[model samples]
Target: MEFLIAPIIVALLASALALTISILDKHVNNYGDVEININKGKKVLDVKGGDKLLTTLSSEGVFLPSGCGGRGSCGACKCKISTDIGPVLPTEKPYLSIEEINNNTRLACQIKVKKNLDVYIPEELFNAREFSGIVEEINDLTYDIKEVIVSIGDESIDFVSGRYIQLVVPPYGKIKESTQRAYSISSKPSERNKVAMLIRLVPDGIATTWVHKYMKVGDKLRLIGPFGEFEKSDCESVMICIAGGSGMAPFKSIFHDMLEKGEIDREVWYFFGARTTKDLFLLKEFQEMEKKWPNFHFIPALSDCSPDENWDGEQGLITDVLDKYLKSKITPSKHKEGFLCGSPGMIGACINVLNDNGIKDIFYDNFA
Candidate 1:
């Protein structure tokens, strides 16, 4: 009977503590109203406090790019905070560099708005807008990849070539709340009225599952514009662009924008990688670009191509092929910059290869 009484006492204590904490959260945590200073007085907002900074800003129509929809998972909603809120959180430390942390950079989704705060926002983000678009078409790029084209009827979006947009996925089945995911735009900037992106299916992923299973050609979707700073540099260095699978989106936009702007004279070598022939797509389109543009070279490599197939292209892992070309075909003295997009693991591997080959000034965008 003593053991039973001890367990009951412990349970009662736990319940009392939970009740006390809940009551305190209801009364003491009500931080009524707060002022948000943006860009040193470019824009100011008065909002109800006690919400995450990301949600509060979105409520005021100043949407920051949040790839995880205020879940604190994606580090995309970072901003410089001038006012003292608190130290950096463990959730944000993985995303923030030492320099960023030292400079008061914090993730908006992780910070609660408890007082008046000053923050810095880019001028370009001020121009970003939410767009409602109809799905024009959906084509199978590969077994696992699908090309989605969205048309904003009579509306136009102006953005740089290598940028991304947040795709708003509505709740379905078990998902009760909406979420946003970022995908690089594959369409050229000239196609102002349309947005195209390549999405690869990820197992049990919220946005990808919606796009793959629930979306149809006539479905209407909401998109947030033209976020990201992954544009091509203006220097005359030889461009070494590497990508795999759906990573081809931004480069497709960049290359076509270059072609339209008559900037194809700059030397470019695009190295695309896949596991097998079935995983490859957009071969003919890029090959045609190579034929018309004298300085553009397209090299698609397969890592696990079977011996029975009559494949003549570069065969090996992408990093190995890149090292071979860097050592043999390309001139070592020519200045070069590496542009990469892929999964984080692939990007890490490619960066190691590029650094080993004496190439620096690398720029990359990795999908989460």
Candidate 2:
């Protein structure tokens, strides 16, 4: 009789607690209108409070660089805050260095807009705008990679060669809201009316899955762009570019721009890494470009080449091959600029090699 009564009492307590929490949350989260000061009153926005800073700024046509789409995972949407929003969250600490923390850099996605605040973002982001485009074609470059060509229609994009555009992925199935992912533009800057990007399928990647499976030619999609600072420097330094998989996009744009503008005199040694012959692509095209443009050299290295592959090229890890070239093939007299695009591990490894070999001018896209 006591056991039954106790069980009923426990259930009643749990229900009462849940009801209290639901009531508290309603009032606690209800923050009203807030003012956002950008670059110290350069631009001000009136946004509804209680939303994350990233989404709030975005609502006002000011898109900050956000790779993970306000999940507070990517840590890309960083902005310096002059006002005291709060203490640094544990989620943001991993991405922010000690110096950055001291400088008041906060992840915009994590900060709740409880009150008026002042934030500073890069000046270039001011010009960035959302553009709608129709998918012109989806050309298969490899089994896992596809070149997505998009026609911007009446809108034209003015961007540098090595820059990228954020692809706006609409909600599909279980995905509740739209999200954005950045991909480097593979098309040359001369084709401002349209754009092409090399997209490689990533396991469980939301945007990649949508592109490979659900998307079709002529499907209209929205994208925001002309972002990123990775571009060719004005200096006539010899560029040593390295790429793996769909990392080939930006380099393709950069090289074409160079070739078209008769900047071929600025020597380039492009090292492309692949696992087998199957992974190697755009071979004939780049080879022909090399032959026509004397200053351009294409060195496609094949790592883990099987016997049946019948491949004869630079064999070994890409960094190892790079070491050999830096020592013997590539001239030391020319000021070298390293352009690397691949996995973060590969980029870090290559950066070490480049640093060891005295190539300091390194450029890379963060979204990679």
Candidate 3:
């Protein structure tokens, strides 16, 4: 009787272990295949279901501009869906507007690929690429601004003149998850294998502080880019650009591209505002470029120049300097376009100045 009981117990234990193994396998490795139908018929991708839509699409080499890298915070990964994936998630609610929700738009990061999905994306996004790069050099462009040069590994990036890239910062000590931040490409478009960005250190900003304090030479980072439409148009109109602090990044790219391509036919006036001489940068480069491009003019304005600094230029607030220039230097009769980039406050002020001067075709990029 004892021998028969022992055999029965052994069989029961083996059955229990087999049941547990099957349950674990089902939970861990049972993601079924799913199909994503894009634009009804433009393209179709078959991928494993159960991952976030952003990650799955990115893995398939379909890059989407995401400032938070699919954490559902930046709300940059938004697309329209023809089929229902699931209800609107709480993480996506804050970023979606009422009109967006009504139009069947959803956050790609929040949606899970549980089943087959039909989604629509902008055609331009198909050109976006992700690149891995090593930090070549980091130089202080200004007191609080650092210019970082990243050398692309085996792949190269082809981006527009004034577009921006999202830099990926890995998790640090207190940071539980990685984060992404967008910075305009300061390097010329001709340098396809190397990208440069001018980053301003914001007091407690997660990414900026990391770049300023923790990041070192030769650190590896990933970047996803070529996003934004802040380029110079082909119209034969005067270009009036205004920027503050690190807002100089995009303008540098645009100006250099214009010089290299010999597209300096239209008159260009660049106004860079700073509190003092210490806050200013790239003056020598701009001066050299000004000599090269006869029609291009670079203006550096100091809002509060100390007497001891021997500063000599337009003074007062940036908007005030811009208003004076519009009234005195630039002619209102000629067709003009205003290009502005800066903090939200400075952009708003410059917009008002441009509007008051009858410059109707104003385009701007503000960092809010």
Candidate 4:
């Protein structure tokens, strides 16, 4: 009798605890329907509240650029809120400057949409789409650079020449969280259903390391893309473009698109830099393109060429070569535009060179 009574009492206590938890969840965790007004009634989203704005918008098929997958670390998910949700969060403070906070900018991942809110986004973001793709081919273009081709699953992506896509990498080992990294699309825009990237292996880089060591051909991948404002403008200007290493991706797309569109009225000088000959790829293809487009020039330079490798092209640091060319071979006019892609250091150096050469209409994308 004593044992039976004790078991009954324990069961009653367990039931009571479960009931209490359920009641608390229903009251505290539940968020009712919320309304989102975007861009002065350009669109409205009726969603269940309690989730972050980023997740809610994504669920509604409005994909925002987020490098850390809504973790609030990358600071890419910024949106201007017209309606106040709450005070700024600690996670967002680091990324937001005083000007941004003053402008009522908030991290979408950290802001819970618990009520009717107004948010402002760039008009171009409406065109951004998520794509499901399968890795079709992975070829080593150089010793350190791998060319990856992804075939779109159902639909095609319409993007400009110098735009990029964010590849989603799932959590592995110590990462503990999934991440997304942006890579410029290397394939021409004419290849609507296919996208390619020139990936350089970065030692210990979270995404590159995974791609080099674990990722396999034929694996399914997801990406959100066609984001960025890097592209050619309609101006009768001489284009001076500079890149290094994996920076070749966007230029490849730009050049191919130019060739396809027959936009040879503008002169283009593409300067590609590498540490050695082993780091170079696609020279032959660019050479062929040069023949087809007389106004376009492909210049590849090696900074540290080994004795065994026979390299007769430009030699030295890329910036130095660019400075020499800008000062001597090319005369920059006000209409000249500079396009640059590479490491942050290379981009900065190239920018200085361009600015010194009186080329002010410069646009660049740096992968850091």
Pick the TM-score winner. 1
> Once model 2 is optimally superposed onto the true structure by TM-score, how far is the C-alpha of residue 128 displaced, in angstroms?
0.8
Q: How close is candidate 3 to the true structure, as a TM-score?
A: 0.85
Q: List clash counts for every candidate, in order.
A: 0, 0, 0, 0
Candidate lDDT values, in order? 0.93, 0.88, 0.88, 0.88
Question: What CA RMSD would you report for each candidate?
Answer: 4.8, 5.8, 11.1, 9.3
Runs of candidate 3 with Cα error greater than 4 angstroms are 1-32, 71-73, 85-99
Indicate the residue-level lDDT of 247 in model 3: 92
Candidate 4, superposed: residue stretches over 4 Å from native = 1-30, 86-99, 172-177, 332-334
In Å, residue 295's CA in model 3 sits off its true spot by 1.5
- Candidate 3, 1-368: lDDT as tens digits: 99999999999999899679757654786569999988887889999887778889988988777866676777889999989766778888898999988888999987878788999999888888888999999999877999999999667888889999989899986888887888999999989899999999999888998999999989999898778878999989999999999999999999999999998787999999999999999999999999998999899999989899998777899888889888999877889999998997999888888999998898877785
- Candidate 1 stretches with Cα past 4 Å from truth are 1-28
Cα deviation at 99, candidate 1, in Å, is 1.7
lDDT of 4 by residue, 288-349 (tens): 99899998989999999987887789999998999999888886443688999998899998
What would you estimate as the lDDT of candidate 1?
0.93
TM-score of 4: 0.86
